[model samples]
Target: MPNLIAATYAPLQSNGTLQLNGIEYYTKYLTHNRIKGVFVNGSTGDFVSLSIQERKELLTAWHQNKPNGFQIINHVGHTSLPLAQELAAHSIGKADAISALAPYYYPITNNNLLIQYCKSIAEAAPELPFYYYHIPVLSKIQIDIVAFMKRAKTEIPNFAGLKFTENNLMGFTHCLHNSTDNQNIMFGVDEMFLPSLGSGAHSWVGSTYNQIAPLYQAIANSFTVGQHQKAASLQQKAIRFVEILVAYGSFLGVAKGLLDYLGLPLGPSRFPHTNLTTNVYSKIMRTLENEGIAPYLGNLP
Candidate 1:
């Protein structure tokens, strides 16, 4: 079975305060949906908008509340290398694994500096496995991916794999093919989940999995059974599901609003990511129902 990890959101009150109280319900919701685990404090979590203290508090809350056997991947990436290392160290015993994207502001294109940044963090949390987040679009830290993966495995003692978020399937495939180690390459693209199957990706991470795992799970099942037409149909539905959320404003905020409708009520998002009104949520529901995508969203209590 393919592994699906939800890149979780930072639940906040309408006043924008941390909704740590919601962690239990969040855990139940994901587990009820059969999600394998969570990738916390990533892009979806609005990590940049959160303070270091808030991020630390979130990591602790998640670890304390996580269901047994569920992996907690803590994203420790920051523009400051020292702070990134501090987060990595802070995650000791709290995180099942630690991950970090490249420093975005004044991003480094040099593969050596990139590896060094990861190495410093990995060293700080020598006990936990480290994953390099490869979302160049956000990090602006593009290099020869195949080469970076090779060097990361060689250089970092605790290097596990990558959260391969980019669409460079050729590089992704090559890295997968040439690897003989235990290092993983968990794919992070939602639309390419089916295509990643072709590249031997057994693990995937995304936010849409929060609301529509069944739709994607159905896609995986269909493909496994040679049901190409049905699989494509479901994948298209998954894409449209995302499109509908995006059609509102910020996909993250609107998605959190969907969680509210589904019964979790995780609360509002921070600025620049606009949360929807109650009326707008009704409109989204109608649109989803009209598109036949409503049934796949499991209700959470």
Candidate 2:
């Protein structure tokens, strides 16, 4: 498991077509900054807004340009089980691992159905490790992950672990400590990452890691050296980064805009997610600088 896996954005052109040519730059930027992997076609990538072919293109682009030592975990979740399976089958040789969110439209409240849904997808790409993307906030299926893990262990042979995205540290802790197998449970809440570290999490996957790998690395280093206050302060800075972006518009949308500063022009976000104008982009940069976060942004291209 990678220490920091960035949930990447889906690059688009002005006309909303896939801007896959930019993946080389994106891959290099993350590698140079020491990011370990990418969680593609996930929420940060605006997967819901993208079509099946578009999603496959994003995964193909990332896989093609993947740097050495960097992993790509493709999220193949869809409301349609058949579509999800199609995606899973497509990712066989392309992705290092595959994950899927619970079906959101009808919502599977029963753990059995959830496991079955996962089982079907896992079977589609029997060669790849499968992770259940447990983001209850979006999926609205608040099933206990610990229970899900127990059932999945018996049923789903290729179940790798979870992309645990909820803020329930208690639940996350239970999943980590009480699992029958050694699960690779990567923490997903970016704002509360410090506490997750304290709870003994080594790996994390989040949108913020795309831009601030150095900052999170600093926090990890500080914690390792017992610099408690320093680590906490750095965590607060991360929280503020999300806060500042959300103030302008959708944090994810604004984050896609920020990637331009690193030299990968990902173009604007899709509908309902705010896209920054040139003036707004400059203003945000100035704000980040004023807020003392510029230095922690790592080496920008």
Candidate 3:
């Protein structure tokens, strides 16, 4: 099966503290939904807002509770090289793989710095495969991903793949074309999953996979079996899901609210991400129901 890894949320209490006890439930939720893996401490997890200690705890909790064969890719990107390396080192045995992003605050002006940044982190966990998290919109270090990746294959031994969240299909295709036999280039745009499938992409990671994995899985299956029309319709439905959440202001904030409404209880978003009011969740559900998206959602509690 093509990998559908969820870029998981950081479950927190109403008071904004880590809900450490919820990891077990979270694991079963992903497994039950047919997801192949979890990408913890990534953009969806609000890694920048979390403390290093809290990230360690999240990693530990997921690693300890993960069922057999459930892959865990830990994101250890940070502004500080030492801290990023420390987190990467920490993931040596706890994570099935490790990924890192460039230092965003001091945006890398050159590809050399970016590759070196990733190279240093990869060195810390020689045992596990390393992926470069190429989320340029957030990282703002928009170097040529293809060129960097080519050099990285030679420069970083354990370099395994990339999590491409940018909207550049051209670059993604080139990266795909240039990928080594041992490497994977995981597409990160959930709404564009069908197009990715058409482009020969078999690996994906995203937040929507948490709620609508079954929907995407169907999309993949349809696309595979000469069901292009059916795949396109399902892709539209998946896009509608994102459109509805975006209509209500911050998508991240209302996203967790939707999870709560469905009984997953991911709790509120951290500061700046903006969680929707409980009163508004029902309206969101109504919108989803009216759009015929509720039918395709993965099983609810």
User: Which of candidates 2 and 3 reaches a greater lDDT?
Assistant: 3
Best by lDDT: 3
Alpha-carbon error at 26 in model 2, in Å? 0.3
Q: Tens digit of lDDT per residue, candidate 1, span 1-301?
A: 5689999999888799999988988998889888999999999999999999999999999999988889999999999989999999999999999999999989787899988999999999999999999999888777988888789888999999889899878888987875656888888989888888877888898989899988888888999999989998888888899898898888888897889766786888888887778888898899999999999996574
Candidate 1 has what TM-score?
0.98
Candidate 3, residue 19: Cα displacement in angstroms equals 0.4
Local distance difference test scores for all models: 0.89, 0.89, 0.90
Report the C-alpha lDDT of model 2 over 39-155, residue by residue, as the tens digit. Answer: 999999999999999999999999999877789999999999999999999998899999999999898989989999999999999989999999999899988789899888879
What is the Å distance of residue 287 in model 2 from its true position?
A: 1.8
Clashing pairs in 1: none
Q: Total clashes, candidate 2? A: 0
lDDT of 3 by residue, 85-186 (tens): 999999988999999988999889888988889899999999999999999899998788888998999999999989999888888899999998899999
Q: How many clashes does each candidate structure show, in the order listed?
A: 0, 0, 0
Q: What ranges in model 1 sit over 4 Å off?
A: none
Q: List runs of model 3 lying over 4 Å from the truth.
A: none
